[model samples]
Target: MAKKGDMLYAWTNDAEIKKHAELGGAVTGLWKFALESKAVDAVLVITKGTDLYDAQPVLISDPKELAKTAGSLHCGTLLMPKLIKNYFDGAANMKIGVTVKGCDAMAFYELAKRKQINLDNIIMIGVNCGGSVSPVRARKMITEKFGVDPDTVHKEEIDKGQFIIEYEGGHKGISMDELEEAGYGRRTNCRRCKMKVPRQADLACGNWGVIGDKAGKATFVEVCSEKGANLLEGAVKKGIIATEPANPKGLEIRGKVEGAMLKLGEKWRKKDFEGLGEGKDRLKKIMTETSRCIKCYSCILACPICYCVDCTTKNPAYVKPGELPPSFMFHLIRYAHIADSCVNCGQCEELCPAEIPNALFMHAQQVELEKMFGHVPGVNMELPLMAYVEEKQERARLKNTGSDMIYENVFNPVLKN
Candidate 1:
């Protein structure tokens, strides 16, 4: 059996699956094996919808139906964990195998910690995500920048710092930096996100480490958990897939690639948050940005962490209904509730009609909470920072806290003269 941390080069033996899959159909083959072997009751995956730009999440119970979910959709910005939580009752009734991007895996981890989903009943297949583009924006970019019909585009990929598109007769490529400079690249949240590999998941699989003769023909699979190892071993033993030890050089290159992506993300984080400034300047900026909120509640609705049945934003005591430009209390309540658990998933900002940089703000707070408590959200099953504080006095103070307490107690402690 494969052990945790074992890296292997693997590919599907099914020619049809290989032809349609992004990288040798290893994920597809694994899902097929899981279903046929009755290892999972269903497979949750994203599939191309009406057009290549429109991607939808699907739950497949039959192995034969896995083909429709093959291929990668970089334009798919949907988070699958929320779907499982809200629609499927956290998959409590079934065993599931699901594909996850870094954000999805993180969100799932947070959900599991809250007992919303039973992690033991699920298999998570992690995909290495460079980033994702907003579909509507991507379509416009393809038509205007690439001089191609967005509807006719066959495939899109980000590699070697370029956004490449394949069409009927030819292919075109443009540097992502150039595109972003022209206001057309990955979503701002994705650009700043450092989590490229879903290391928290069962198996992390991608094309990053498959090189030399196996380049583009096999997937680099990192077994992150015993569950992942078992799935891979079972697939190989069942003759559904083939595997070989990954090349050491290829593994090194993969690490370098991830490092570069993380470095780029750090640069983005600095660029995006630098304008917030410090002290009153930062407070003023946040207040100014949030003042534009029409209280549409889109951010709260789209948030994976905000699962409270009686949300504070909806409570009249905190925020009056039909209030335009909702009270700052609404925003404050949300930040306090979700900052420790925010996974920087970008859904809130994406769904916000006011275009508030919700992810950036929440992530900034999450970073602070992390440093203060050494609790990194979504990387593991660890409880949130507030969970460990057992002092009743401190809890009472926290319950009665206001915005000033953050600067006084958290950000800048008052020193006695």
Candidate 2:
């Protein structure tokens, strides 16, 4: 930890960074600062390819390359394990910088608890998540709406209750509010998210609702730890950037997003977080919804936490070639496996071409699991809550099987009936 009052700079996605002798544009100022900071041994940014001209998450040492990958810094979520593996593989001992979302940061926290990475030497820059889109679906939309040629599409977003798809050749917008919009940018995992802010992060940054000023300059920054504060402070003291209070509108937007999630949580509470119906009905729904799947294995690739040496789907011992759906059991088993650990990031649902809404399913189950266990998966690192530990203290915290609760007030009143 660098301690409080260290060098730091923060900004929204709209903030532009003037590079060495190059024209300035919207860039993740932190990445630019890291590039300028010769003290940093290496910089690892986990961002999307499309965001910065399809730049991958890798080491960017040269200033020019840093500029090219600057768009990646705006990404709200970057799966943690991939970046960690990159560091471990390189065997880099020097102070390194990496980006992660709230859930991904929590994933790192879990891994750190298990002694997976050395957190002392690393710089964790976090971003508050709005959501994410599957690259495959994004490409599909481009291809279907405006031809697959990269030159055709210029920009994309969900605007004014419509999907605004802009192109160099021509532009067209679809009313997402009207259409049966599924897949791609519509993140299913985000629907059940309760935490949008990065709690365990050293530094948190995002755009969410923060746009630049009339001068087109807005900065989104949150210092969660001593090192993060120091980084931003150093940047300001060194005259690299200016600081201002976050926009009040940003806080209002944050509240709305949080409120929406809380409402969803309340709905689940009313449902008792139980299965929709009996075993047959629930299984039938799963089968019918999953029937559309052709087993493209895209979800497995997008999933941040699904890591197995060799997946059973690929193993000859478990699966054979030319299997259309690969058995509903595989889907159910895989869902159950990741259910407890799922952070509700929504990548699986976003990536699935079949649009199965597995993310929502996970979210519903997550509520139930949380109610049952009184645990939030990766919130607290000091105490091991997700993993089962024998403790008399926890027994009281666990949900009772209805038989455990005493019927004192309600039951006595019902005797009159």
* Model 1: residue 195 alpha-carbon error in angstroms: 1.1
Per-model TM against the reference: 0.91, 0.67
Cα distance off (Å), candidate 2, residue 397: 31
lDDT for 265 (candidate 2): 44
Q: How far is candidate 1 from the true structure (C-alpha RMSD, Å)?
A: 5.9
Error of 1 at 295 (Å): 2.3
The residue pairs in collision within model 1 are: none
lDDT string for model 1 (215-292, tens) is: 988999999998999899999999989999999999999999999999999888888778678788888888999999
Give the CA lDDT, 0 to 100, for residue 330 in model 1: 91
> Which regions of candidate 1 fall more than 4 Å away from where they truly are?
387-417
Q: Pick the candidate with the highest lDDT.
A: 1
Task: Please give, for residues 1-417, the per-residue lDDT of candidate 2 as tens digits.
Answer: 234422222332223344321112222455556567763666776544644224366776664465445543222434655456444642236666776666777666555544445577677777655444455555665566445564466555543335566576677766542332343343445434556667577776655445445122343566678777767666656555556665567667655755664675454434423444536776677678887777888777666545543465564434556788777766775666566666676667766778886766665666666678676666766534434432233344332522212222234455324
